[model samples]
Target: MGSYGKLVRDQIPEIITAEGREPITYIASRDEYHRRLREKLTEEVAEFLSADDAAALGELADVLEVVHALAMSLGIDSVALEELRQAKERERGGFTRRIVWTGNR
Candidate 1:
């Protein structure tokens, strides 16, 4: 049996397969996965900054996936962090408005 981390990584292929499509899900003996992630982040950041709504949404999803991987690496539960965010939003305010930065320099 593979380790928990390996199992989690392996699930990427299984998920793609379940979606009625084929995808290269294995990162074995390759750095392509990390490279693709970096490329996706770059694309998303560009789209987000350009105010492309659809692309921004896609990029946000990619960013969330990266965050999930980071959380998994740190043995942290992402769901708990999301819940904390929700709680904080309730206590304070959600990201509903844009804050304008006045020249303070």
Candidate 2:
């Protein structure tokens, strides 16, 4: 037993069994899922920030997976989420301009 009390990928138990170790896991309730999803997103983001360029892509992928799960947990499909993102981007614009503001008027 690795003694992990954290959320893990769905296939993790199967993988553990294949490695000749038993993994104890249970499905999370909807409310608990929401809470854990928040934690997972923060974890993945921190990992992405701390990773080197070579490892960064993998970390980003993990972050994206967490994002997808979080969205789905909210009953938001990918298309609807993308639409919302685009709507916000169209209204407020994206970061492509690389603008910095220093104000003292």
Candidate 3:
């Protein structure tokens, strides 16, 4: 009985029906889908940042879901995405060392 103009999982309407509710929904066109995916990513990141200790992992998982969807929208599969990530890490290293940049000379 509420209005929410945002992207959601494909199974959400089915879940709502199972819960005995009438859920209004529609499929997004390709361009709209891409735009909404970006918005969803920002929303998910905010949730992840504000999540408490007990719920942090769950929020992080949601963020990951948005990320994967965004990547796929750009025609990148998981394997290819992983390869790009690894390539970047190899070139610039990762956060393992916790290196902090100080003021330059």
Candidate 4:
């Protein structure tokens, strides 16, 4: 009977019901849904950062799922998102740099 007033994956309610538990839930308004999704992104990222390498992959998937939902919420598709990501990687490069700036260079 724990209460978690947070955004969850679409299948969560069904999973709860299948477990022989009644899941009390309601649809969020568009604005609220957007807000909750942002919160979920932050929450998932924190979880990923704290996980061990093996567990971090699963957490990373959760983070990507939130990213996909956020992109769709903003009317962008997966292909477009990936294109933007690639473009940015090409322009500014990604973590492959691993260049650590200590202090005043």
Candidate 5:
């Protein structure tokens, strides 16, 4: 059997079972769950960046789901997160301008 000790979607085990395979899984501790969720965020972001146009949206959705989990784990729900995001956007702005700075001046 292959080893993949990473966080996965809630329905993954069910999907595995539907495919005629039994998935071996266990519950992670609170700290371990937070750590794994962070790792999953990184993994999903990389996957989203590398995906082709046809699969990019799905990969991006996975990344968002991971981000949501991370926020919840940190005691910040979506509304709070969005509030923080807007505050940052108002103060520092966002990437809308597509500005590419080259070096310190």
Candidate 6:
């Protein structure tokens, strides 16, 4: 039996093969992935989108997988990328506070 992560990783290539063309999978899956990512981002934006927390978490995992694939294609290590994220967080305040818009509506 494959590990859960392995099974999920295998699905990408399987999806490609089942579609019988690279573009089909890329187009379909990428759009689906983009939609889900957008939903998650929207939730974060509004601060009231926790109804699909589990689903959103899964979508986030999928997004990370896609991003990891892209980074690998471009010869980037995920760990190094994360370190860069940490560095950025150090330079800028992290997302722990809410922004208040007090200007013109």
- All predictions: root-mean-square deviation over Cα? 7.7, 2.7, 2.5, 2.6, 2.3, 10.0
Q: What is candidate 2's lDDT per residue for 11-101, written digit by digit as tens?
A: 9999999999999888888998888888988888999999999999999999989998999999998888899999999999989999887
Q: Which segments of candidate 4 are over 4 A away from where they belong?
A: 1-4, 103-105
As a TM-score, model 6 comes out at 0.47
In model 6, the worst 10-residue window by lDDT is: 1-10
Q: Which stretches of candidate 3 lie over 4 Å from their true place?
A: 1-4
lDDT by residue for model 5 (9-103), tens = 89999999999999998988899889899888888888999999999999999988888899999999999999999999999999999999999
C-alpha lDDT values of all predictions: 0.61, 0.89, 0.89, 0.91, 0.89, 0.56
Better-scoring candidate (lDDT), 1 or 4: 4
Deviation (Å) of 74 in candidate 4: 0.8
Residues 1-105, model 3: lDDT tens digits:
113588998899999999999998888899989989888888888898999999999999999888889899999988898899999999999899999999899
As a whole number from 0 to 100, the lDDT of residue 94 in candidate 4 is 89
Model 3, position 74: C-alpha lDDT score: 97
Task: Give the CA lDDT, 0 to 100, for residue 99 in model 1.
Answer: 67
Q: Model 3 scores what on Cα lDDT?
A: 0.89
Best by TM-score: 3
Least lDDT summed over 10 consecutive residues: which range in candidate 3?
Answer: 1-10
| Superior candidate under TM-score, 3 versus 5 | 3
Q: Tell me the TM-score of each prediction against the true structure.
A: 0.46, 0.89, 0.92, 0.90, 0.88, 0.47
Model 2 TM-score relative to the real fold: 0.89
lDDT tens string, model 1, 24-68?
444433354444445555655666677666677866776677666
- In model 5, the worst 10-residue window by lDDT is 1-10
